[model samples]
Target: MAGVGSEKVFENDKVIVWNFVLEPGEETPVHTHEHSYMWYAIEGAPLHIYDKDGADLGIFEVPTGAVYSLKCQDGYLEVLSEIGKGARVPATHKARNDGDRPYREVLVEYKDAMPAGGSV
Candidate 1:
């Protein structure tokens, strides 16, 4: 699903960049990420994760200037080694701002040779 307020800032063959902004009590629509991506936190704030049915997943902290590399299946895994297999299909989730301030972050998604079978 398309994110409610996510904007594609830049895109190329190798990478696609997205800018996300959530105000107080704002939320992003149910969406899925189909590629390996990293995020840079701009305005850190409290956020809540939810499933497609709107079930509360958990609360997560968005630290300022924090960098996170997220795999498809695993949400946030430590990159101990550079050699490892990645997921073919990415993960899906929704996010909401539970804090009193705004939440901002930059996401850089790396396109991995396109979809194998075909584009969804």
Candidate 2:
């Protein structure tokens, strides 16, 4: 288990920036997103996701230059399911690079935006 990203590149009172890179066939350790965050993809690839118990979730396509913002909230999965538009990044899960090319993204987590008790 680790933090939200592969490496913590920068951090201050307001936010934490992370560099997330996954080579082909590489998988990240189980991690949790407890704060509101956003990510900008540097490279596009298919990412396979699994729950903490190793249950398959699905393969998600990361579009090049795509950016996503997520809020930390209780019952986020339910909320996202109702919305039915954005990809749902689980509160606790692991991700594997399923494509031949590497998957890269820069993630910015808002420390101040962390929900009380880190629900997400």
TM-score top scorer? 2
What TM-score against the true fold does each predicted structure earn?
Answer: 0.75, 0.80
Worst 10 residues of 1 by lDDT: 79-88
Q: Can you write out model 2's per-residue Cα lDDT over 6-119, one digit (the tens) per residue?
A: 788899988889998899999988877777776788997888989989999998777888776676667243222212245665688888999999899998787775445332
lDDT of 2 at 17: 91
List residue ranges in candidate 2 displaced over 4 A: 1-4, 75-84, 114-120
| Local distance difference test, each candidate | 0.66, 0.74
lDDT of 1 at 50: 78
> What residue runs in model 1 are displaced by over 4 Å at the alpha carbon?
74-90, 113-120
Candidate 2, residue 57: lDDT: 91
Predicted structure 1, TM vs. truth: 0.75
Report the CA-based lDDT of candidate 2 relative to the real structure.
0.74
